[model samples]
Target: MNTVPGFRVISLPRNTTVRVHRRSATIVLTLVVLALFVLMLTVATGAYEITGNDLVATFLGGGSDMDQFIVLRQRLPRAVADLLVGAALGLSGAIFQSISRNPLGSPDVVGFATGSASGGLIVILLVGASSVASIAVGTIAGGFATALFVYLLSSGGGKVSERLILTGIAVGAMLASVNDYLITRATLDDAETAKAWQFGSLNIISWPHVIPLAVLLAVLVPLTLTMSGPMRVLEMGDDSAHALGVEVGKTRVWLLCAGVALAAAAVATSGPIGFLAMAAPQLARKVSRSPGISLLPSMAMGALLLGAGDPLAARALSPFQIPVGLVTAALGGLYLLWILTWRKG
Candidate 1:
């Protein structure tokens, strides 16, 4: 294994070493490089076919005004927004999976996204609160509430595992029903807007959505990363974690809070974009071949997934681009089915 600047490229026979595990590090770096290449390719793809040279010039601030405008204002921001949201969702999913010790314990699986959607709908439908902040707050409230409900339902004398997954699925179904009712009962205009929001979209991402999400990620991701030790401890089972000086309950709570916050912020910023969060972490862990969840790799994998998906969505139909969420949801649903069946057999 050769170590490069801030990264190591791992060779075949993988060993289990703690400090900067070479295999995972190398694989992650490789994925990141590939992701960047894909991102640049995507930037060049659009309604107006911009050449690689033009893309490079535009990136270097040497292209025509129109090129700059298209690249910088329209496409670039959308790409960045996708990266942020995807990374957030990926990290959240990874954290949740690690904490719950179950692959099925995702925000969508646990009803956090559905719950957040319900909250956002309440603001849009009943309270007449159309502001972004209101929606963001509602999403956070909804996600945390759903998590709390699941926790309470699954908690027994002690421990949480398979019960949590069952509880989450049930809660998720209930919240999804509530979300549907809210949408169906609203006016046509409201219903349309809610539909778009609920299905998720990166359509109207302005500075407002991008800036707040960026800031939140900057603060939360690092904080969550610092809790990795406790998270790993929790994976060893609650009693063992407690025995190992890890505050079992507190660690779970912190991870849950952080995961909910990340998911809610993403959902609020771009509605509950299906599968990016859920899929990215799983993909990252699989690709990296890590024993437990790999947070940083998951985030990178997410950014890569969305970074690629955005361009695919942009150019898939030319002038009329389908929302990024729908594209991801379709693919995600298929991938999820494959994983579930593969696991079963």
Candidate 2:
């Protein structure tokens, strides 16, 4: 086999070959290391202040009980959840952006996140459901339903990307109104809870929140990685992908399902953390300089962004804390403006 200068190729027993991009791989590794550093910092910088030594000792099962509880029971779960949820959003963003061939094609930008939020609000405000599992189901259902609606609306025009995005924005606006109405109709306590969830906080995260999202990602991430090749192929347009023996329709459906599920899982866990999904893949692509959205790097970038944001949100105000979602939204808003102006130029 001929060698590519920037990619390393590995041969399998059955004569299969895998090519890995060196730069992308390096970027992913760097992002992962940074993510781990952020995770440790998150676990350490809190009211209790577990030093690096204490953190290592606690994880190794040698720290005092108070240190263990503060680290393990309280901070660790939130930190882990931040990483897992961020990875899910990042990967989901990559899938959507690649599929649509548009950098603005993230789940949040196209309304899936809002749809998921709508579902969760329904469960929380109308049905009075309090469990994470129930909300997760609602969010997933809502995401899939919204995807279907947008696809059907976009299919008629033969401009799926443009129509899908526009339709999603419209639908998302309507849903936002609905979400607000539901909150108004709800009791004060329920409204407050729903409002807080909408703002997206990591404060209440526990093992229960972390475990399910981690398990879901364990399945979804591998499935997404497997589909990455087909996803990249589909980027060359459906005609090319079809000529190459790819099942264009089937592949698209599966990709959309996986993307929606990832986004929904993140929303379920973190109440639709804003802009991480949209920003992570684009940032990853810029840093890696990959021709298209790279899944692993995007996932790593997402984890790093969220992991870093959480600590800032927690400590930025000292006595008062901001939601991580707000931080991402502020940053993401600036990024959006910059990208738009830069692209125009």
Candidate 3:
């Protein structure tokens, strides 16, 4: 391991290396503060308007019934959904990106989200599954199935990163087309419902959805964080990882499954919120200058982007709310361009 001045890199047993530094603490802190600000603003500024002071009063149990209903039952749930979805997307993205050692290897790009969306769409259009529980089951199943397919296809070739990425891309493209076609074949009402899937939104978030997603994130994010060491090693390439005694096969399978679960949870909660999983890790690495994608920073960036983007999407065109998915796509697209230009220069 290489270390420069003011930095210490620790190599532990089993080929785990730890890097310690505080250079980006302030930046992360600032982002966290900003996220909190955006979240409160989102909760307060809506159709059933509640100002900052009123929001605090409601939280402390003083607001009227309407305000309480709006904040507690509606706006609060949506905000929580945004945060949970962001965290899931960010963590999922970091896991896949590190595992593949490629920026394009995100759940959105890789077919997990597409697969999940397709599954949800099928349940809605074909089986008439409208209940939360059934939809969740279908969505998660689709994502897992897609991951298995990708793994199987790439396994025959030794799970090469490039090959897996290409396979996933091909699968994702096919699934996306299928999703559109399914929409076309559905009835008018079903088609309208499916349109929301095309552009992910948080307007329909309820306590039931919020609770499951929060519970899943509570379990999964911490679980994924525990593999950071192995993830770091695995990203260093196959030979180095094996030399470090990392169980190349087992670790990859676990991380890949965890990533699919995370991505599936987010998609199930908020539709295929495109570009979030792809953008969050890349943005974190850019800001922190970490050797590889840092988990906490990526989660924070994802939360900040989605949390803040919601309100901006609402207000960007007065009296007309754009979908959060569109906001993320536009924002992520600009960031992608900047990265490309910066790399070229």
Candidate 4:
């Protein structure tokens, strides 16, 4: 067969596949090493001195009951919680950022986290519910409803637009105020509990938290990964995306739902940990040096940051034991300042 003139046969590997795999490997390795280091540090702290041998022995299932109790029952759950929360936030942030095609389009920025927090707070305050199930349900509903509202209000003129950002900010601020009110009205005991949640703590986490979150992640994280293909396409500007056969609205909704589910689950379990969502994706992009949104790497960064940050916060404050959220909030605040200043100049 004769080849047609001016037609060159060239095989090109998809950039998306290569980028996803390379970024995923690097990020996952970094997260694993950091997670192990954090786990060791966590086991070493507190009343008992858990040395290298102790950690090894405990993990081998050969340590004393007391050693096992401290490692398994106490520190381990908290460490696991930190990792789970980090991963959830990282995935959620990447999804939101990609969908909105704005660096500031994270769940934290778009009010999903705040809305989740508000819903969890309502359960805590009005319903006086303390179970993880109740809180999770409330958070999922609240986060989803808020995003839908933001989408709708922003679409007043036509399709989903930049106005969604503005509406989300307004909605988030309002929900935040309500959260404060709930906190203020809580009884002393309830207030203490609510405060811990609002500030994002891993102190009281247990197997109960671990089980539900593990199940949620097993389902939601994979869904988030699968949706990344559509998100990447959607990032190429809306009109171009639609023209290329991408269902823009449907993709956005799916991404939003997955992101909200992940964020809401984290909020229900750990009470809206600070900036992991926003910070993780930014850090992942920097590390991977990949253009556009990097979901897998962002997740790895989230796990690394939270898993490591918890222990650093623990040691920095000693017996006081600062909440992980406070540490991240301070870090996030610095990042926010830098971003604002950079924009101004």
Clashes of 3: 0
Error of 4 at 199 (Å): 1.1
TM-score for predicted model 3 compared with the true structure: 0.92
Clashes of each: 0, 0, 0, 0
Clashing pairs in 1: none
* Tens-digit lDDT track of model 2 for 1-345: 787888889887888777888999999999999999888778887878667887889999989999988899988998998889999999999999998888889999899999999999999988899798999998999999988888787765355667777888888888888889999999999999999999888888999988988998989888888887889899998889989999988898899899999999999998989888888998999889888899999999999989988878888897787888888887887989977986788
Ranked by TM-score, top first: 2, 3, 4, 1
Which residues of candidate 2, in runs, are more than 4 Å off?
A: 51-53
Which runs of model 4 end up more than 4 angstroms from their true locations?
1-24, 44-46, 156-161, 340-345
Residue-level lDDT tens digits of model 4 in 1-345: 243343223344673232234554666787778777776677667767777787789989988899899998888898888888888888888887787776677777778889998888888888999898898888988899898888878764443546776788889999899899999998989988888898988888898988898898899887777777678988887888888889888888788889888998888888878777887887788677676778888887888888888878876867778888888888887887865775577
- Residue 336 of model 3: what lDDT? 74
Model 2 — TM-score against the truth? 0.96
Segments in model 1 whose C-alpha atoms lie over 4 Å from true places: 1-18, 51-65, 341-345
TM-score of 1: 0.88
- In Å, residue 265's CA in model 4 sits off its true spot by 0.7
TM-score of each: 0.88, 0.96, 0.92, 0.89
Error of 3 at 185 (Å): 1.3
User: Candidate 4: TM-score?
Assistant: 0.89
Q: Write model 1 residue lDDT over 130-218, tens digit each, in one string.
A: 78899998888988888899888988866586777788889889888888898889999998998888878887777678889999999
